[model samples]
Target: MSFMPPWFWLLLALLFFSALAGWVLQRGLKKQALSADANDVQRQANRRIQQQHLTDLDQALAEGRLSPAQHAMARDDMLRHVLSDATAAQGNGMRPQVNAASAGPVRVVWIVLCLAALSGWSYAQLGAAQTWWPLPLSQRVQITATTPEQLAEQTRAWQQATQSRPADAQAWLTLARLHAAQNQHALAEQALARVLVLAPEHDLWVERAQMKALSAGGVFAGEPWQWIQQVLTAQPLHLNALVLAGSAAWSEKRHDAARAYWQQALGLVPADSDAAQGLQQALAQATEMPKLAEAQASQVVPVLTPTPSGGDTRPLIQGEVRVTPEVQSQIGAGASLFVYAVAEEGSRRPVAIWRSTPTAWPVRFGLSDSMGMGAPPVLSSLAQVRLVARISKTGSAQKQPDDWQVELEGVKTGVQGVVLNITGR
Candidate 1:
């Protein structure tokens, strides 16, 4: 349920109370005016009676029925009575005026107090009182800090919301996107899995496959490959799936397959688009290479190695990844560990990537030009590079919260082997 802002309700209450106070003051003024009018009528009646008495006395004196002393005494008595009645009427009128004036202010004070109490109570019950706090200017700067605290908070909120509304596929999809962006691939995959369960669609499956490939550092095999295959089976010309399939084929050195997939993708994309331009370049490069025999196209390309008799003598860097006992317990079964070399400058793509199981900690690996992801600018071409060893519980090379990682920077190519410790960092 959506809630209104406290200020909105407060303003509404103020308007309502002001209207009510005005109504009370208006009623009081009307009553006071009526009382004053009644007092005036009574004063007029008393003057009339006094005038009649004087006329009666004058008539008696003119007829010689009353003596002069009697007339004077009667007039003086009527004057006293008339004066007393006028004084009483004036007092009655003033009392109502004073009470009406005082009633307005008193009623306003009471109304204000009541409205304030009601506002407080309503806000406490309806608003986010516990979470609400004043955000000072000093605290605003910290919100932009490059740490996982804010992301973690958002993840928790999304998790709670997803749990509360399990049937909300869009919420689950959004949660998946958030987790994926934060490099929480395991949670992200879990959320996507939920979305698939709730609402299975071609685009979602393709997205899942893309995430799978990204988590594996652009390698698509096993389950990730199957995801793309499923989408292609349903819709062969699906743009995203085709692109991912092409990338996977390229990574595996299946140039013919990659070319075919990319050509199909190029057809779907706009001719002037960046993707089309890149695909055109790749296609041109593929056309220059000798065509593979049909039988070779169906088979996986074998990793060629130099024979001991006449092998290429380029140097190779050797390394071992070590995991501390404290962090070893945190590593789950089937978790992937990536040890790779990236160029310090120009195209930070991994020159060579090696994957290992978490249980095989302290495993030895070799980095050479032969292990390069693609042709050109191999490990030997770069004067220096950074060697990174990461333990990915989500199987993603991207860093996630609580992942163990270690890097050795400025390591010269063809140098002595270095040891990297995958301690939590």
Candidate 2:
């Protein structure tokens, strides 16, 4: 049912009571008027009877049926009774008092009270009684925030709302989108996690995956890719999921996979819409990227300067990441390749990381100090490093069963040529 405000019901009640009270009072007044008319008719009939008796006495006296004294006494008696009736009729005006209980004002008051009670009871039963009281501050919806101050206030309000009503999945979803809008990907992912627990719809799964990927700097590895896979498995033709999957492939340089996903999604959207136009543009870009890559392939490695600034003259670690033909045949177009270098000792965090799709075998790869994860422990600072290349079956950084991997340990930084053949897991 659609929501109705409290004042609307109250006003409707008042109008109904007014109409009913007017009707009841009118009925009572009409009854009293009918009773008064009946009494007036009876008074008139009594006067007529007294007049006929006086007339008969006069006739009798004229016919010598009675003496003058008798006639005079009878006539005087009749006249006195007629005068008394007139005085009494004059004393009691047009409407005689019928009953105190049947008064118009009393009936109106009773009607008002009864109607008020009935309205209150009916509203309590059929209407939203909570609307009669103010809602809690946290439960109230905030207007769209335009300014930073307003955004902060709205964020706090939504946070309080989620805290107060922890099971409200819609509230959590809204808060997640709000955080996403403000570019707070980590916070958005956290809020989306609540939504996943409370209401794990397919669309929300795609949204959570997107938020998580954004939090991980546009890398759809591990959990994010898993979420996307779950959604695609459930709803193969879901439009938003298709779009997101295409974008994820595009991010991993899987142009063919990206083009396929976008093509499917493009068919679902309206031809003239902005979404369709965007998909078309992405498809066009994906189509041209492979050609560009092939054109620049020969010139790519030779153009790289072999020396470094800071008086360190050492070539970067250049390598070929290859997969066996049998294993390559089993890989899908969307599979991801991770070539990274970590320190020989200490933390396993990659000092340098590069990601791409292994569409072709024996791919040229390069790693240098500049390719580090923008943190401490530069690649050049390490004496020796562990060079690892792996092909993820699920297009994720994390390894799973049946993936292909190869590792080269004790590889010095700035190694001239390295070949890592990804064998079967």
Candidate 3:
């Protein structure tokens, strides 16, 4: 059997003692009443018997049925009986004397003590002593402060909870993300490993790959590359995996491989999507690089944009990105900024995109169809879109804590000079 705490045992003891005291008090009261009633009955009977004898003696004397001496003797005997009866009545009629040891102040003291002990023990057992008791003002202030130590404490609590519930995939994922936000890649990877065991899904693998790449400073080699390949093998058209593959190839200077992967991804991605815009930019950049004449003749690189006509009639969306003074101070040097236009509804792929560093505040940016990822939802094709600008501390397109961004909804195609802000995350 499970053992209860000391307070529980103390509570039980108090209850038992209190109940015993109450029973003793009730029994004493009942016995006292019974004794008093019996004493009253016996006193009344003695008085009645004494009166009858006296009446008989008086009759005998008045009727001259006996001599005066005999009457006197009888009267003396009757007097003796009266005296004896008086003494007996006095002893019996008096109230039962309370035994000092059993029912007087000492017993009362024991009862009171029992009751007080019970009350105190009950309060101790049931009160909020373990949680939320009133704290001093200084202690409350210290508890509410958001210092680094407090953050570490919170992280430890989360770690403990995850340890206790190892099967909770979401919890593991959240812990991993938290570690990543703190730039603790090793710890984050450890948590992610747990997540992989608990929940093996394509999206999670893709996320792990992204994390690995970020840890490598945007290099998509080693385990991160392997993870991407695993996801692609399972799902050939996985959008994120295909995008990462293309990016990895481009980073390695394998332009042909990058072009092939991007082309495949573009076919699967929404035509007028943000992803398509990114892919288009990559493809365009690759095509612009000088090529050997013989290789160029053999391989015809696909061009997303037609040669500029007279004045370049291609549609363009222009915007200015401004950072609030309060937010600007929080942005670290060399942080990356991404500005893109995405369709307002359906797929959230960008129609066009521009990337830069935060060195220039209120930077001017422009995008056209040539910057699109694949081809479908080109900037000129969409009637309305959302223009977004984000300052990413982790150099990631994914939003994280402390990342700042601003957006304008329902912006018409070809709109010029639209202003966006980098507000607090």
Candidate 4:
């Protein structure tokens, strides 16, 4: 066998001795108590039965079924209805019946001690208390842990630590989180309690409440709703939380909520942008689209401003006509330029608001304003469009050509949806 720790071995030795001692003591007690109970029982039997019972009692006494003195005591006690079940004394009824002259407190103390020890040893002859180690206590008395021993240690340490320094509420809260994650529901809740005790402020209360409610053993199934109320109570516009709460004004379909969030995002972005693109989708599905009806109402109204006709009637051979960055509208090179407009939407195909007269140093090499219209281009519908803009580098649309294409290269700058491409040579 493996060697045990010093304490274990000592414990085993102590227990073995204690067990032997207890066995002897208990056997004696059992015998004494049984004897007493038998006496009591016999006395009771005598008192209750008529002379017919005397036969049984006489026979029991003769057969040694009952001790003579025991029988006499039982018989007397039964007749007088008095209890005479005291243990046998050694010398006298009183503590050694000390003489008045010698009855010092010290002597009395000695006599008392002797009587107590005698009583205890005599009592053990009948029955005894269980044995246990005095110095080394039971670790089993400690808290629950991974294993019985481990749990005992953990419990012991926790108790000892708590005795030395009470648990902090923050510490409890963190422990609660860890336990909750582990599905240690009860432990998690206990930790949460500590948290509340330590920090009962509104924020902490709310946090504790959330953990308690959401905790496995916690009221989670019931708490998320209450937690939601708190979150909204503090920050109503919390995007995701509120969204999750359900669009109160609307149904489960988060159209309004989604729209609002998307709009919020869209406002901070540039047009023709990815955000704008997303917003466009949002608008399509928004309930507030009607509220924003004015937005789309005018959106369909085409973005083409009328091409301002210049006084020039010349097929002006202009310098390089460069297109505007985002919108493919052309700005002239010289002091003068022409302009044009295409019908709305598709306008037969991708038509320019207007084309510019040719020149050198076109920032874009190929047919930058590139998209092909069929053989003879047809207007998409009666849509307003940017035909062209013939203008000077001075940012001026001079009134000069009346005969040339008299286009926007010959017109004023206004709203125009120019369809142009730089790489589509």
TM-score of each: 0.43, 0.39, 0.39, 0.20
Error of 3 at 134 (Å): 53
Best by lDDT: 2
Which candidate, 2 or 4, has the higher TM-score? 2
Ranking by lDDT: 2, 1, 3, 4
Candidate 4 regions with alpha-carbon error over 4 angstroms? 1-164, 201-210, 213-221, 235-425
**RMSD of candidates 1 onward, in order:** 13.4, 15.6, 17.9, 29.4
lDDT of 3 by residue, 160-232 (tens): 8798998877667767766665445556667778888977877778767766765544467799889989999
Question: After best superposition, candidate 4 residue 409: deviation in angstroms?
Answer: 70
- lDDT for position 16 in model 1: 84
Question: Each model's number of backbone clashes?
Answer: 0, 0, 15, 63
Local distance difference test, each candidate:
0.69, 0.72, 0.67, 0.39
> TM-score of predicted model 3?
0.39
Name the regions of candidate 3 deviating beyond 4 angstroms. Answer: 1-164, 170-193, 199-204, 210-223, 230-255, 262-315, 324-336, 346-353, 358-360, 368-383, 392-403, 422-425
C-alpha lDDT (0 to 100) for residue 122 of candidate 2: 83
Better of 1 and 4 by TM-score: 1
At residue 148, give the lDDT of candidate 2: 45
Which one wins by lDDT: 1 or 4? 1
